[model samples]
Target chain A: MTDTTEAFRLVVVSAGVSDPSSTRMLADRLTSRVVAAAKERGRETTVTVVDLRELLPELPTALSSQLLGPRFQRAVDALSEADGVIAAAPVYKAGASGLFTSFFQVLDNDLLIGRPVALAATAGTARHALVVDEEMRSLFAYLRALPVPTSLFASTEDWADDALNGRLDRAAHELVLLMESGFARAVRNESWKRYQHTFGSDAGRELGIDTDTDLMRLAAGGSLVDSEDPFDPRTA
Target chain B: MQFGIMSVSDITRDPVSGYTPSEAERIDAIVKIAKHAEEVGLDVFAIGEHHNPPFFSSSPTTLLAHIAAITERLILTTSTTLITTNDPVRLAEEYAMLQHLSKGRMDLMLGRGNTAPVYPWFGQDIRQGLHLALENYNLLHRLWREDVVDWEGKFRTSLQGFTSTPRPLDDVPPFVWHGSIRTPEIAEQAAYYGNGYFANNIFWPKEHYRRLIDYYRKRFEHYGHGTGKQAIVGLGGQAFIAKSSQEAHAQFRPYFDEAPVYGNGPAMEDFEEMTPLSVGSPQEVIDKTLTFREAFGDYQRQLFLMDHAGLPLKTVLEQLDLLGEHVVPVLRKELEAKRDPEAPANPPSHADLVKAKYGDDEPRQPRPNANRGDNVTGGSPYQDSEAEVSAYPTL
Candidate 1:
């Protein structure tokens, strides 16, 4: 079932504001490490980088109206389609950048559910390093994405040290292992229905309703219940 | 197909004039606007139900009943009557009474009203919105169809032998349209009940609604209502039309830019390109509307939002003239030509529903059996047999 010929799609979303920002630098480093890890396992990797700054103008409108313009929609599509996510945000005001969080906020709640995501954050000092575990992890948890236990946080001082690279390597390896093992796809395939609420769903019908139920029968305009027998002779 | 306009009944400062109509003025204007809808040759005039400020249609039945009295031809309906907050018993009685007053010139679209705070105000929890909507509508359905209903549900108190009166005119409940913007469950609910599904086609792109309508059509057939193409579907549209495309844009731009709903969000051009909104000549409006058929297949109703965003009544009337005289007539012929011969050409009207229910016989006119102290113990609540009562109108 493992198709080594298929290219794994990795979407790197960087929320750094400046052109020479360290956040993008960290994101690029993580993507390369993950790509190399996949290559070692005989899996080709395709990377798409989404810079949050390009979409800042559209975020306000997207936030207010729940309508995403074409550019923002393309970025969202890339993230949703990715086999794995490399998310890096610059910490601001003791939290992730508003642009970083808002982008994910407006996405469909189910888009990222059960997908593997590697969390990374860049800040001015070591004190804000906890932003990765405290903020980004919780955000991905809410989205139901699988965040590997290895969360990477890079600060100004950490950049000068070799420890940042080791953390990146560990997180990248975890993401590659999860993506290669096909755990995300398996979970999604097997349990997607569990996450969704469909109309006239079994759960909904089971809530003190049945074929003899006047509303249920009347809703179908006096038709016989066919929910159970899909190949009913009448329709067939 | 039925073509009409639905208004949110928002009162806002007219961007061009810097004037806002008083609640009294706005209310009067809406009545005049509805009457004009008939004068210009439209089929339905539906109004939104809102229980908060900036919106004046707190009581849609009162306004719709008034519109019914003035307009002889137009069908009075709601863009949506709140199915989540309002009591099903009250909905059953109030709408039934409205049906009698209008002489069966009415139907209603039900929705779980979108405002969050409104839930608690009506003693409902927003978290339980879907459950409340499902349970309440189930009860409302029974209240209209059954003479006396004994029911228990999660959202509301239990009912035993409860009878909602002014029993639906001619023993036929008003045709129901379940309106939803994006909820597939609502579409499924609509399909499950064999009711009409109305897609509020404003704000969002066509693809968003296409999926919902497609799911509804499939489920409509799956539930044995009709073929997918024959399922009842209605779409909400927005248009600002003028003699020329340029003038339409020039005139509507101010309102489009600053209007409350999507104002300052997407530019008018982008919005028009994306959604069903049209701001152009009558031909442009027609061209855009025809594409809806291409997207959602043949639908039964097309309602436009013509009166919101502080556009004065006069401008709305002018837009209606374009819609009635230029846009709708052409659409009616074009859509008819394209419709499948077997598919229903119009939504079920009061006359059609009564005829379907009673055939050539007289429709039911319930005469309550002389104040039985308890309807539960009585063998039959009405003086006449069910069949006899149903035959009274014909006699």
Candidate 2:
């Protein structure tokens, strides 16, 4: 009963610093909105959190050495394959933390290229709220990331105010919509194209069923293509 | 040459515009500064950690994680990853996870933190800070370098047979830089292990650092990590650059006055009197920094602090524009020309981790499924725990 084309994977990357952390709160809000929007659109979603605060302590050694062990390799594989990503952090000293910056230094540039990213930050006050747009967004641009237009900024004031919280809620909703649109575009274009090519080339020949009833039986038998146009012309 | 910038947060007013930005503004300013650093072709950007009032960056790793999503080439590092108070177990797991999230662009500076109150807050004693750093880092080092560590120490519970999950990319842990302002022990530690020794020369004079750097260099040579200069070295700086020297000074004075550390403390006078805090044109900053070579010898990494003191985002951005467009280019050309062929190639970069992981054909065979579950490796610079045991047992 599972829909083959209905699931979307979403990742929320929160720095997870313990005190006065608006970043985590914003990440939760964004995830909630993204999940809600996906639900409204009848798409199932899975959210994974990369909590930096929790994960940073256990990073391995010899990061710059030629002798890479097994554990670090697996982490790289996950990031390169992550679907939709949401990165949230606490603003510090005008830029990302050294720990946060160092984490980015180890990644391959191509992995994040064209990934849809939603950036958010939390701070004690609102003076540098645009840092997400200025510093973080700029970094994404360099990475060739497809960053969503709306970045959420939560200061102490915003967290305290009902009106500001409402604004953040709206922003989160929009962010998820953007993420879904990006995901859909990727699926409709890339995944659909691949699916079409497979069916178009080998559909009838591989199934070994000539008649329509046979084709239906084969399809029911889980050996044949079932789409309206298995050999999709849109991709062709 | 990996260049980075770390800000010591101090809420202050902008000298030129007279805008007094809050702590939040200071954080944003640094982010903009970091972005500009990346745009200008700098390889890394780092931030400091401080937990008291007037200093905003209590959580450096979280901020770096956010930045990880932003830049492609700019590696993120901590100016200081407190080694004394922070539990090694948490440090290992969190950084490993971040390595996965960022793909590989991460490293950190291990330090015995300066704050005293933080010791008790984390249920540690300030007096035992050095002992904690030594023991914790040793355990941490093993946790990253070994597959399954059988570790025992005085500070934390020992691990008989522990394997940190989510191993780093290509199984390479992050390059560590031990940052010390005054501690000779830290420098000795960095030298003993062939790790980078970062003499954050922000507050002290050239002479003050010479002794430390010399000690590190001598010890590094003694440990057979090649010649003294080849021993991994890095330094911190502070600067305010504009088109004209007068403009830079005029625009930065008020901000300096309001900087909490430099605002009311002796640090400002000492900085002006002895240390290098360039409030001038880019060339002046360059000249001041070049002088550090004489004192500390040719170091590997050089970082700057340009966005502190609540400078407005606009000013910080402009400074970065100058740094990228003008300052760094000249410095790179000049520095490269002066380099000796034997100088160890600019310390291993972040991109190397990925190349090691996927590039190697020999180790690509899929690991056994059951063993994979037990070892769950990651691609971060830090090590994982003996298992995926939560470092925050309290959590």
Candidate 3:
């Protein structure tokens, strides 16, 4: 284990469309609170805010081509390399914004697996606040990201409500605790092989081609002729 | 290194002229393009295989046989012969017949083609694509190498005492190249068989293929084929060229912007920088191509995709002229200069394969024995076989 002096890198992905959207406001509040909480816990913190609006023009191209444009790649790289991620998306049609989902969709499927993610959502009415719990939580769960227990939802009225700050503080502290605990690094270091696809893994075995098979041996330039019995038993 | 061109056989309407060539015209133009490839001093001319509309290469051997009759020296090959859906026994027989027709002036690249729906059309499931590719190639490999094949696998029906006709020209099967864009398993497969690995290095970044090629090289050595540096590797590139860079970009932009595969995706400059696409002067093409050796190490073949995106045949021919006269000659020299002496100078040709197999002796000319009523009653079907003559001889 290393000392607590290392700076914890946090990335905030804000999927607000407008210049001063409340979704971004909620993101900024969450990021600052997380940073402050980390500092209180005697850990230094650095934050990168990825504004998804700037990536809109390239998203379709990225999705269609399965290749990321440079700008979008840089934003994705920042998130991928960060120690923790704060994802905040505005709710539209009772779900997280398409732009937000689209951004994550274009990422490599295994990229966010085992990373710590904090989910937040903003909607016009309190009725859609469950978008965080129902939509965002499931999204991160599918990605295999460990979402902190406390999810933040800010509605039109929640902005002025004092309880919003309390919820933000709780969620931010949980994320900071996850970061300081080094759960992400532990999972990445200890059991990463368990998560990856490799030559003899279950996926490779499922394909019916493993390393020791005759197909593999032949591929390795081994002769198929000189074996003790050339006929397959199944055929016999 | 062997420098050449490949076509996906897409029939798109010319974005600028708004005219689409008829199937007859496009097919004729493709043959003209192939002959022009040989005339321009290019060594290889490869055509793709597609079973659906918008692509016209369903019968590659038919088209290639015609191309073979017209040209003497051009090495004919498929940019990719579909291995997933096509029956391996048929692939073995058809390509063997092609080898005889071309007089061993041919080889093939195998790929599990990208289209999903084409699978069921051939009575196969798309979910088993990789398995089908693996099992089919395994059967195809044995079909060409062995005199008689008794095989069973998941996807295809059992083959008992099957002999793929024509028995490969001079008993040397056509050299194979496994072409893949993303699958490391394909590279592993290539390495395992000591066959060539071809990275269709278009539409993606060099870094993407670098990892794949690197894995192949390492596995090639791991399988004891050769040192990693000596692995036979081929790469696909895309280029449009002219005397001046401005003219090249100006002429190719309309086609590039409207191309069905990559159109409306990235800016021209960004795409060029990201992929192996060079859209400028012949000198720019030469310089960009030379960098591939540095990126992926000295490779065996460099094939460019030059005919798609509905560029007029006249312009495509001109592009070939520039490629043959300018870009390829310089690339050939520069790549050879940097190549390691121990590394393969070119991919194995018909002559090389024959020599490797026979070693100064006369190669086998297989004569089938008279067919018995039941194939199982036969000891062996060929005249050269040491098995007892239980079946009547052809004479």
Candidate 4:
């Protein structure tokens, strides 16, 4: 912002269950460092948390019918306006929690186009450390979100490792640069039409109708052909 | 606004009785349901088209024509005629023949069928459904309006001066309603032609339908049809009514729990909360139906899904009695009282269309010219028709 007082929105979606879970703690560390990095660049930042545990009751209806309950709508609303997103999830088996993947899967594919995201995960052992980069990053990539290169995966031992702090700082620096540059906002404002979107998409803040499409012309009873084929096999 | 009933023609096992009606029995029962709807004072009867088993209406015109013979005033229509799979030429001819048989007591709603496999069965790819719907309807529009159609499109075989007969009754085509859940292109097509737009708001929440309906109304005005409120609109509602709220719930619980599409998913109560499903006494149905007008404004038609989920003939008839006697009468008066005086009274019926096309004059009864062994390519196809300059160049 020109005044340097407006806060860049940072939404943290953590699927950690327990009160003081490591997954959220990992996301929190990333969020704080991002805020600090942005502040160093003379930009303000504000963070909003989306706890997937609170969204448990709404998941069944959403998974079955694609009906967004109130809590899910709020999450979509926050993410739509987010300048950057820190998505953290717990590794249950060899994969990310279904809750985390489902929350992203059900979102309108255009909702996070070009959005800066920091992917992180927590598990009991370092054996499942690749969950963030290998699995969760693919999900955000499908949504067209821009994930920072360094994925944060903290196991029980990595929580105490000083190297975890270095990786978090690098991700934060990359996210702050992406947000400060306004890459997501600029792409959305300038080239949103290039993306595929449906009418009632969650990213339906734009109700702009392009009357220039061939479909619109056809809707107005215009023909799809520019010139009739010289050879009519039906007649000849 | 006009009120009616629509059926998916589902053949489900009666969750209470553990019995499923045979295909012949279900087909015959559908005709009886249409007659009873008319007997009870409902204004319209529409049936869906399904190409699969357990849903019997593959030929809607055949069924609607039969219903039209038994009932005098009940408007015969389709909840949705597949616009994507069926050739627009056949649609134009068959629907025209039905219109003449029913003597202008019919109209049809068009949709891209949801069953994906059914698309391939008809030699069409579901991936091209939207384009098929838009392109096919464009050809169909001309088939009914022009005496001879010289057309070509990507999806279907090209036509060289093809005549879809017997040219629409009184030279006026049957009114069309484009039914869609979320496609704005379908709504735009409906608006461009000033046709009625119908949304089945029974399964999902009203908010989803509201956006598309609002878009239709806005584009309806943009296309120079009329004011947004004056644009013809239709909605779908579902209900199971009885003498009291508890009895309504008790009777419908088994069907709601075992029915396809919605069963084993959201609880009936949650569905009722989010959608246009009303399960209660007559007053409760009326009250819930009233809120639809509040959400979507004064519109033309309301059709309820009454005879599905294997409620049996006897119970469905009883539900219709409550609906016709108890629910619809109150809804009619309340919606009428609340409707803007300038809004349309009902969707354009055949007579309304004839009057609009030829006001205060005799409607043209098209007569084929005596062309020697030629159908459509001879100068003009009808005694009173002009040869189109270039049907494929009309943009």
Q: Highest DockQ, which number?
A: 4
> lDDT tens digits, residues B183-285, model 3?
6668888988889999988876566667778888988998798899889999999999988989988998999899989897777887887778998998899
Ranked candidates, highest TM-score first: 4, 3, 1, 2
Cα error of candidate 4 at position A215, Å: 0.7
Candidate 3 structure quality by residue, lDDT tens digits, A1-236: 54578999999999999978999999999999999999888888999989999998788678777667877878867866778999999999988999999998877655676778889999999999788888888888877788999999998899899999999999999998888787767776677655644432221121222466554554443434444433433333
Candidate 1's DockQ is: 0.21
DockQ of 3: 0.29
TM-score for each model: 0.89, 0.56, 0.92, 0.93
Error of 4 at A86 (Å): 1.1
Instruction: Flag regions of model 1 displaced more than 4 Å.
Output: A196-236, B386-395
Which CAPRI category fits model 4?
acceptable
- Give one digit per residue, the lDDT tens place, for model 1 in A22-130: 9999999999999999999888899999999999877867887776787787887787678899899999999999999999898777777778999999998899978
Query: How many clashes in each candidate?
Result: 3, 89, 3, 0
lDDT of 4 by residue, B34-109 (tens): 9999999999999999999889999999999998988899999999999999999999999999999999999999
Ranking by lDDT: 4, 3, 1, 2
Q: What's the residue-level lDDT of B254 in candidate 2?
A: 73
Q: Find the number of clashing residue pairs for candidate 2.
A: 89
Q: Listing candidates in order, what is each one's chain A TM-score?
A: 0.84, 0.66, 0.84, 0.91
Clashing pairs in 4: none
lDDT of 2 by residue, B151-251 (tens): 65556776765766565555678888888765556666777777888877766435545666787788789878788868878888888888888887677
Per-residue CA lDDT of model 2 for A1-236, tens digit only, reads 22345566776777757854667778887788777777777777787776666545333221322111233334445555555678887888877555455455545444555567778888877887888888888877876666787787888778767875565566656655655566545653455333322111221111111224322222121121233333222332
Q: Which regions of candidate 2 fall more than 4 Å away from where they truly are? A: A1-236, B9-29, B265-270, B351-395
The residue-level lDDT of candidate 4 at B24 comes to 94
